[model samples]
Target: MSALHFSRVVIVGVGLIGGSLALSLKRAGVVGTVVGVGRSAASLEKAKSLGVIDEIASLEDAARGASLIVLCAPVAQNFALLHALEPHLEPGTIVTDAGSTKSDVIMAAKTALGDKVAQFVPAHPIAGRELSGVEAALNDLYLGKKVVLCPLQENARTDVAAVRAMWESTGADCHVMSAVQHDAVFAAVSHLPHLLAFALVAQLVNAEDAALKLDFAGGGFRDFTRIAGSSPEMWRDICIANKEALLREIDTYEKVLAHLKTQIKEGDAEGLERVFTRASGARQKWGTARAAVTNVEP
Candidate 1:
């Protein structure tokens, strides 16, 4: 639709992100053929059956002459995939990813592809749901969503433009950032929050009155823990992949949490109110800005 197109695009995971991307490209009429590849043959077959992909191919066969190859698998699986792709990669092929953690995957791409690493552009689509798999994938999942691209110094401008155009075709607005910056930012805002949500849910589940506590949980609890319903395997990889940045965030959070504990133990009403007021104000401001941008409500 935007005069940008890909002849043969390979999706390495064929799950939520990958399947939705394939569907979006098909809907936009920007792709000639979408090939699905993954660890599970059943998943690939399911994606093909759902019309999310035009065909199913092995990772080895999908790399040759591919216009674009998007690695949408769990972050931990990327290195081996890239290593496998290196031998079959064509000069015309441009590789990218929808990985949540970039720095680690960039490192993997560099290690796996060596001098050809420039062909790989690291990207993260700031969109998804608690639901996963091809069945949960939607054509409009990336509409009005944000995508961050971290390009390497050796990357060609044309290759970068192709990746940008691909995401824009799906109605995603793309922004550029350095790999280190991308990792640190997501570690604070994304990874830490997911970690907290999982921790809270795990705590409740381990409690003596787990069922009672869960039954009594209200809207606030549900809202806060919603991300806990995300794929455990995916988050596990993201957490470890970006652990250095996440650990720093965790240490900082612990200090803030300790201070709050002190205030509560001393019955410092003013202190508590000040913190609450600041947090509420910031959250409301962010929500308002986000609503204006996305035009979607909670």
Candidate 2:
């Protein structure tokens, strides 16, 4: 199969990720046809009205003809969708996903797809905002972003390469990692941060002094907790799915917090300054790394 030619690309659950993918595929001219699959007739209609897909298809029907199948649903729904569509998937079809946590999805694919597990490539695109649904999608969402593929030991090399090529065609830099490592890294950087934001905001709102808290919420508070506004359902699922890693991250964060508290209690100005300086330097370095990854030179 030509790297540039995808005969039929099917996107399951045409929400933000799926819709954005369809738009990107169209922009890249990589697929001849894009089919969107969703249970909600309204969402399917909205996706079509927004030009996210060339056509809408039932899950089974879409699986029958797709050259590539992209699962863009919530992590919790992936297994059920996999089982339902497994029997219908055409042989040699390349199946991939945009779920946040990968291990469970990979396991589900293996169980449901069985011999066809070699055709599946579990992927996570490290780009999203605190929004949901087809309306939140933009064609440029994946451009210059990192898309990580967690290829299984048994996955076909050609299938993995094809998946990498598809994401690269959209101007995304692709990397390969094991499912366990992917989940561990994301649990710290992605899942734990989201959980913290949600917890912080929820704590404030539940306080009797909520109005006073809001009045004092300036740029720092807003910026720090921006991810708190993301869909609760999605974050809830992510936290539960990656609980072990997230718990470890939470423990690490608590230790840092304890150090800060101890310094404050002892009135150790030098200690506090040193801590702040180290944090600021680390944040600056991270910012530079992020800019390097997302910035493309013309």
Candidate 3:
């Protein structure tokens, strides 16, 4: 079985992730033709000009002869997009997504693709930059990153393997799991952190001395809130799509914070120190483990 090559790949959203995927695929010589389909003509044009796509076409037109299709749009819109794309997709065209949420996407695919659900693979590439758009696309964006695939029950072994191979060609380590498990893991680690970052920045922005505090903000503040500057619409969709898991994570975090607050209020230095030490140690261990896994010198 061929691993890397696709006769044609149709990328539904030619924004950062989609554009980068297109570029990386082309660079690897895995795709013969890259067709980008998006609502914004300007964005598609930019993607084309930057060589992220060989051409731009309507979803109906691009799906005509594509061997593979990738939905790189927000999770909320992907449901409708899949329905809209169903009639246009040619036989044997394998579909996948670069969405953050998995369960909702799997349900959407099951509903829209129906009998053809086996052709669709739900995937999430756990890598991104703070930037957005075709202009911010990088060919190496997924290199050394993780790409999680939650294959539908209908998916055949070959379909999953093809999609996994595509991600691996971009230097991403591919992992397969159930949609429910993927969502729960990501909700705790990625989604919760993004929400917290956004909340912290919002709190600061709405503060009485907002301008003064922002002006005096240091590296730690900037680092923690960097994700707050991400696409609002995208994050909003992610939060809503994975609301259940995210809420559970938020509740757990709140409980932890409340316990720490009580420690501080009671002047329990020992408790505070214990909590801080545990958290610090855990963070350091995680960082080191992550670096080792990704083979990055630390």
Candidate 4:
């Protein structure tokens, strides 16, 4: 298949994900003009100055003759953004997203766009950093990362293929799954971990000896809570969006934690060792397999 190129691509948020996508497409020569639309004027200016975007336009104007529009804002904002864009959205303008959650955004699109819902292809790129904003955006951020596409049944195959090509052009591998599966999988791996990281830091900060503990924090603590530095507003929306799945994961985790606590308190050394050894072996195996298969671009 010939490489698909979008002449004009509009990024609604222009943050790290959006900016990185713009940079990636530019680097790959798959897009002409990168237009940025956002609530923050200063951010748009910064994205422009940094060459992340070629022009700043309103959502209304940005929709005109756009080959592709990507909504990279916080997951919850998708509803409002889609609602606002629906009226101005022109025919043949394909919309996609870089949101972490899929089901909620798909529902939002169905509600807001109605018949135009087919034009929206919900996607999530499994790529990011501890840093955020346009300034932190890197052209290679999506290189070798996974992008999940939960396309609506109403979506044309050509539209789905176009969206896949767009992501593939950024050096990402695209996988197709139902929105329900996408949400459940990410809830376990991504959302729950971020919640735990933030909760750990919250526990430490609220402790009476927080200062002392933090002053002596070692690599273990740092490594465990590293994701706690992620965007609070963004993760807040994600947790809320995928609340049901996340709550289920949290409940399962609590049961495991209780089991471990009991094992420790009861001095069941063998039981603890059994669990730890199994976990360590699984993690190592997964790491080795992933490293062997993944083409991590430098």
Candidate 1, position 121, lDDT: 89
- How badly does each model clash, as a count of residue pairs? 0, 0, 0, 0
Candidate 3 lDDT over residue span 1-298, tens digit each: 2446999899998988998899888777799999999989998888888888998898899898889999998789987999998888777899999999999998888899888788898899998888888899999999988999988778889989999999998889999889889999999989999999999999998999999999999999988999988988889999999999999999999999999999999999999999999999998998899788877853
lDDT of 2 by residue, 247-286 (tens): 9999999999999999999999999999999989999888
Of the two candidates 1 and 3, the one with more favorable lDDT, higher being better, is 1
The 10-residue segment of model 1 with minimum total lDDT is 289-298
Which lDDT values do the candidates have, in the order given? Answer: 0.94, 0.88, 0.90, 0.94
Candidate 4 stretches greater than 4 Å from native: 295-298
Worst 10 residues of 4 by lDDT: 289-298
Q: Which of the numbered candidates is closest to the native, going by highest TM-score?
A: 1
Q: Of 2 and 3, which scores higher on lDDT? A: 3
Error of 3 at 111 (Å): 1.2
Alpha carbon lDDT of residue 156, candidate 1?
98
Q: Which stretch of 10 consecutive residues in model 2 shows the poorest summed lDDT? A: 289-298
